[model samples]
Target chain A: MSTPFLKKDKTGICLKLHTALYGHDAIEQFRGAYGDGLTFVRRGAYWILSFADALEEDVVDSLDSLLVLSRNRKK
Target chain B: MKKFIKADGWVKVPVQTKAYPLQAIYSAGYVFMDKAYLYLDLEAKDKVVVWLKPKAKADLDKLAMEFCQELLNYAHYFSSLKVNAESTKLLLQRALFSAAPSMVKEAEEKEIQDLIKELEQEEEKENRKPVKKGKK
Candidate 1:
């Protein structure tokens, strides 16, 4: 599935995932998975995922899995 | 050769892409994050222009030198990491071995013994060095 909020730039792609409420916990998870290629920046109430160009597919897949799991857990 | 030009208060340093890749340049830029505001531009297919604007009142020449130094430091850092990648992986694996609960006790014991033996040998080599006597 495509990430609707994902935006492309010269450096890489960015996803608007609002995980700021969870603090650094959620950020740490993505960092552990993506290593140095990915960074998370807090913009207002939302967290933005800035990822490298090479790992665009991996980032999208991981985000999809994360979203699905989170939804399943909630149910 | 690296080229440097001073324009106003900003120093523009030209770095070859072959000598230092974008990743290394970016790493060096990150190191100067608190000290200067950095702007990177592609001068050519093989050249990158780094514009450094000092945050405080500092010598432009010195800032240029420091930026070049930072670039070399990052270049060496990345090259060394590439060289030691295999050894680093081995070190990490050894470190994580103890965390694996399913690992065999006998194998862990042997690994510990081998590490102790290596440490003992290193200590012995250190002790074998002659002490220098001070002149009276």
Candidate 2:
């Protein structure tokens, strides 16, 4: 079965990111950049970013870099 | 700590915060950012589940082992940072503190120059003022 963090359904694959870890600002920045290709929704503590197709490694790395940048700035 | 499980496409590593703090986990993940696609989940209050998918097709066992080593590297690095934090801060401050007097001196010299210029301008103005001629 698909996990809460990663899901695959009829629509496509969606990744849920926790705001507490990555923070809201970074997620918003990621959304701003990827909003055209992705759908971002807030269910609760997590922001679920959905993609129509399976995400490539670069896309995932982009998010990872954003989160790390945010975390580093906060520190 | 040696436990590394290989799933269909991802390698799952369950880390305990007691052994590997969250900060260390983030640090470790950062180092592996170029190597893998990472997904983090909360397994428990103190346990973090790290899911890794290698960017290239490679040995899962070796990849998992490297990740664990990366975790240990960061864990020690962070703890050492904590231990040296005060001294590091003080050393940095001391270095800046030593350099500050020269900066302060430069500012003081500029201020003195400005004051001298103001005084000279005032003197010039005083000299330029027409003196009232007294009846001889």
Candidate 3:
């Protein structure tokens, strides 16, 4: 019922992002985890993952971790 | 595609005949109401006044149906409901969230948890009933 990804404005801007995991490989990995119902979009700084089913909690956690890892790679 | 200018000064983007992105169009509406804070504004402003046209209601409805159908296809695969309750839940969530996250609305994680509970209940009901055995 709920969306696979939730959009938020970390910065107060007129934008509602459907951000998922980051990086090309990370996004692909996430799609593989939840079956073939997802479509990953690469937009600027984030990856948008669309799933027909509400993604499982574990999937979200894994994605969050992946993003953290991606962010850390820059440093 | 003719770039028509609206009376209220918004340059209306042409709806492309060749495979328009459904998400982008619908996302615009979400960004307007949720991110732009238009709906939350205290001013008694109306979209009708701006000439965006009330006719877009039909287009919006059609887009919603398309989105739901796509959602239903995916939902049927994992859903436990005999009548496809998971698809119905997806429709409900879209209406509530408008495809955007807001602090005022309940988190999507919580919504997913609630839906899982409903699915479990449905599964329980199915298990309670007995299957008839055939005579040899």
Candidate 4:
């Protein structure tokens, strides 16, 4: 389930989320939940969550939940 | 012995999941925190690819070997803990039992008395110090 924001590169697949929409805390939460399979890096105002090839599907599912949680917290 | 591929300034080490689980990889990475920047990737199903980049001017080969050794150490530690889990649980229960409210109160009372005695001894030692006579 790849979204427009999620794409595959030479290294692996990455999901890019805006820091404004998710905030910095989301990175830590995602990393804690996914462990080594998930690596996060901040590029300008966006946080990119890169997942290993083997973990692409799991990362996508986790990302969906993270976005849902972020939306709920906003309300 | 596991083989690691060296390229440029980074070492790509492959770890078998059956021998060293993800936890062991994490532990090994933590142990090498000061020496190198460790990255773990599960590109394959049963293997973890560990990329170790030296943080300082050091021997990459030696660091890679040390990282492998650390993984084995953690694997052994984890396996031993699993084997002794029941004994550990029992020990913890006994420890908690021994640390009941009554036992804690008694220990606190003893500690307070010891602290008071030490303070009094310090005061006495200060009192016995020779006083400097002020010039008239």
All candidates: TM-score:
0.47, 0.70, 0.22, 0.50
Per-residue lDDT for B83 in model 2?
100
Q: Tens-digit lDDT track for model 2 on B29-59?
A: 8888888878776667777788887888877
What digit string (tens of lDDT, one per residue) describes model 4 on residues A1-75? 333234776557887765544556755676786776667778876677778765544543454456434434432
TM-score of chain A of 4: 0.74
- State the lDDT of candidate 1 residue by residue for B1-136, as single tens digits: 4446866566888899799866677677767766775654455678777767677898777888898898999899889999999999988877776677455576778899999999999999999999999899
What does candidate 4's lDDT look like per residue over B1-136, in tens digits? 5556876667888888988976777667666766675545454667767767676888777888888889999999999999999999988866975878686677789999999999999999999999999999
* Model 4 interface RMSD, one decimal: 13.2
Error of 2 at B55 (Å): 1.5
| lDDT against the true structure, each candidate | 0.66, 0.76, 0.38, 0.69
Stronger candidate by lDDT (1 vs 2):
2
Deviation from native of the Cα of residue A32 in model 2, angstroms: 0.6
Q: What is the C-alpha local distance difference test score of candidate 4?
A: 0.69
Which runs of model 3 end up more than 4 angstroms from their true locations?
A1-21, A55-59, A64-75, B1-136
User: Model 1: residues >4 Å from true position, as ranges?
Assistant: A1-75, B1-3, B99-101, B104-136
Model 2 Cα lDDT, one tens digit per residue, A1-75: 233246666656777777666678877777777656678789877777777665644445665666475557554
Clashing pairs in 3: none
**Residue B14 in model 2: lDDT:** 86
